[model samples]
Target: MPIRYFIKQWLMPPGLLLLLLLGAWWLRKRRPRLALACFVAGLGGFWLMSLPLVVEQVARQLETEPPLSVQAWSGLAGRADAIVVLGAGRERGDLAWGGQDQPTGTALERMRFAAQLAKASGLPVLTSGGLHYGTPPSEARLMADRLRDDFGVVVKWQEEGSRTTWENAQMSAAVLQPLGIRRVVVVTQAWHMQRSRWSFEQAGFEVVPGPVGFLGQDHGRPFAGLLPDNRAIWQSGQLLNEVAGLVGYRLFY
Candidate 1:
């Protein structure tokens, strides 16, 4: 726990902020010089982080055309292993009802993709997630229900009690092992596939990467995409976090 806390702090933006604040205070005797120095340093740090570039490069490396058209997944209707969907975000639900009715975010995207995959492959789906906050049904349960009601796809649930990637791998593997599910078609955002694949493989699952929602290319207006957008920063943060996690998993897990 201590190590985890240490790593978390070390990886966040606030840690850099604190360093800048302290350096600025130390140079307070020379106010103008200090102000200029701090401004330059802040910009330097942001540039050094280079999140947008990192995200773009990673995305470029992993990007693929949408796999198995609707008809293809529908064709696989009975022979493939489970379509495993990973969780990413959560939504607020009615507190009085114990989160049972809260809308979920990325879980929905995962399910949508899983449904397509299930239709193409004719395989039952496996949804993996746990409640990290509030009182809602576990993400896996909510996803399973969505699969049944919305797509008519049968699903198996792996309610991972993990709040991080490593835990997700460990918990999901445990659930799949009992059912002899060794090979899985993993569905998640393209940006996340590298880390997800690594973690699952480390956990002894044979993963067939089925990435979705790519961020690198713009098919219609190519010029507009050349300029970086706000999402670039977010993507960069995700990439750094995944790299850090991979290192941490090796060192500690």
Candidate 2:
């Protein structure tokens, strides 16, 4: 795995929280007061992550782009030259589809939305992603396959060597810009769209943000989302990662 992946896993929540709890256990007798502080921080962090309301609030601040209206779907061609679907990730393999790698739920969400936009506007589609752990059948190819087989929408281009959002924009630019395609509609999660749009714009494209899978809306859970849910932890992690990516891209890219 990449060193950056390790750094992120250790520095970000859940992993970081785990470390704090471990520290608390190690220091329980040696430094009682410090250990209690660590324990409280670690447990409190997990509790906040497990609350849906916390996810909703953080997501509200991150998901700046609004969903496109249904009526506007068919008119995408007038606003852009093509649709670009940024891959989230891919499932390694499963026996259900004869052990072939499949797009993850996040990637499928992007493909589904891209298919709708493609069918409505008749614009060409480009899928951008890289290999799965440096292996064959890149994410771009997986999404392209699903789009064709499941959605009946063909992908005109597959830039299949991007591992980061910045790479997605830069690699897609290398493919589309040469063909005189400069304007594109970028399809990605709502919280992810801001960084994606910034990267694509930096790569010299006229971007139309096509965001989907918003998480900021009401959860309608018991106690108004005060209740803890395991899924909320994952949602909170995703939103936090987006915030890190937004800052990282501005710093490094």
Candidate 3:
């Protein structure tokens, strides 16, 4: 895994912010003069950069749902060769166990959505993910088990040895090609759909983005919409990472 990925996954935005705040406080106390100004500026910049209002507004605009003609998610779901659920959130049980194998949060949501789409369309479902940090079962296996037990759906498992979005596409393509799969309905969070679609397309797969859990235009007060959210800041960083990865993939892969 890349160093950047490690930082983003392990440190998290809030953790990193806390670290920065601590470092700034130390500098302010120690130097008490020139360094204090620098530390204060850095702290101010961090706050401004992470301000929820700015990030959320930009994300809302940039991550808008694809047009009906392009998305046509329901229509595409009906025609897809496979419903591919990309991993994200984790299940509560998984978190409690500290096992990477379980589906948490958005991961469960993606699986459920994919299962529904598969059941409705009669398309096979492909769950992707691998052993993250020595988890007992890979994410794929966990999601597959849920499909079988909860939905009575038999899904094909793509236990990809991937730890990132790029790997997910690359490994999934390798696994799906042999099964004569051409097009897939890719399921993931709304903020993640565009980059996921772009990566899969770059990997030579025809993808119809099936986005869920979007963070845009919710029923909230005007202040809520403008308020700075730490989650939004983290999401923006993830999006920026994806955009960078896309550019790198286009140039190198």
Model 1 C-alpha lDDT versus the unseen true structure:
0.68
For candidate 1, lDDT tens digit of each residue in 86-144?
87756666586475553355567777888878776667677777774645567777777
Which 10 residues in a row give candidate 3 its minimum summed lDDT?
65-74
Sort by lDDT, best first: 2, 3, 1
Query: Can you write out model 2's per-residue Cα lDDT over 81-165, one digit (the tens) per residue?
Result: 9999999988887689999889999999999999999999999999999997899899999999999999999899999989999
Q: What TM-score do all the candidates reach, one by one? A: 0.75, 0.98, 0.76
Model 2 regions more than 4 Å off: none
For model 2 the local lDDT of residue 10 reads: 85
> Candidate 3 lDDT, tens digit per residue, 83-130?
888766344344555743457767877877777777667788888777
Q: What C-alpha lDDT, on a 0 to 100 scale, does residue 132 get in candidate 3?
A: 59
Candidates in order have lDDT scores of 0.68, 0.95, 0.69
Per-model C-alpha RMSD: 4.2, 0.8, 4.0
Give the candidates in order of TM-score, highest first: 2, 3, 1
Number of residue pairs clashing in candidate 1, backbone atoms closer than 3 angstroms, sequence gap of 3 or more or interchain? 10
